[model samples]
Target: MGIPLSPRPARVIDLETMRQRQQARKRLIRLAPELDGLEMVYHLPSESDAYYGMPLLAWGLREDGEVVGLVPWMERLTPCQSLEDPEHGHFIGYRDPETEELFEDPPDHKVTELEQAAAYFEYEATEEPTLIQQLPETQGTHALCMDDSGEPWQLKQVFGWRLYSDGAVEALLADERLIDSTPILPGDACLYPGHSRHRVVYFFQRQIANRIRREDPATLEALALMVMPADQEG
Candidate 1:
């Protein structure tokens, strides 16, 4: 008779904690070269902590009591109903295992409760929204960045006088440059779709203004027209 095959043991891993730590470590490693010989301090939230439906890790690069950089990593989470008022709607929050703190930040601003409810139901109602919708859209006023080859680097969405990245429901509070620049309006959408990519390392057009602003999309498109492959020229 054939020997019975033993069932493989299930890998019991805390994925949220693992992801948060990985991102935190990655950010530190990337910035290590920039710190040179200076010792940089990190101020990350205790692990497994959630903030506003996302797992978060905060680190401040400091020396001699002054901060040079602040990096915060937020991980996505599974969808869940709102605890405050279930009849009002449902949402999601990041889950971290290293820490016991849960995020308690507000979810919407300026946008009405009904509007937020609509978004929660239409987009985040299910476990995941359709992939195409999940992809960032380059509509309304935005910050834009382009590579030497003229490809879009990223898009920063603007609402009212405030700007936001696609799917970023709340404004990013840690990036100083983004906070300093004059907020863009909907009419400015065609102006700065991927500009922030030029300043921060590994910046992309689809990313939000988590660091600094760079250039406008129209300018990038013009540059591309002058240098891009003839087949790509429009």
Candidate 2:
């Protein structure tokens, strides 16, 4: 069965908020058993790289039903409403697990007062909205990724995944056609929609930055502004 992506309301609070987040993440790890074999991508920026614009946290699942991630820091995975919230980082479009396509809004669903009260433990139940409701609307954004030759490929969506918690929404995207032709390694660039100006983001890696710095210091210097740090609370 496909795992549900929506956060479950916690009515009982036996643990602290930090522990709750950790336990929630751990529960997700258990749910996604397929995630065990897949590579765990990281973003460890070096001293030469600029700190600005680097991603502080990110999480996502692959179309094949495995979790794929790139993380550099884990500190910023604090519970928040939406992954699109500026506090999290640039919003990589959320992929619908069933249809495997990008989407703008959360799934249509409503929470009843009893459900909210039974699920919420952090605070008194005040008609808490579903976790997916916190996501930003992206109807206008066009999701695209760059290939080795700098060509853009549109991403397809997979639906059925639902948001269960506040912080663990998946917005990272991947394309099989693009990956087959040219694997996206660290330093590869992709367009990040939603920003007013042209914003290019790269999965930051220390070794890749070193290599780029050797071949073209100027390019690396400029790309420093667009590095997306792989950050996870896990």
Rate residue 119 of model 1 by lDDT. Answer: 40
Q: Tens-digit lDDT track for model 2 on 1-234? A: 998899979788556987766654542211111222222212223322322222212233222222333233222122112323333243343343445454333222211222333345333223552333222212111222233333342222211122333323332333343454344332223311211121322332344445553667775565434333311111
Could you tell me the lDDT of residue 148 within candidate 2? 31
Q: lDDT per prediction?
A: 0.29, 0.31
Candidate 1: Cα lDDT at 42: 21
- Which residue segments of model 1 deviate by more than 4 Å? 1-42, 45-116, 119-184, 195-234
lDDT of 1 by residue, 13-53 (tens): 99999986655443211111111111112222433243333
The TM-scores, one per candidate, come to 0.20, 0.22
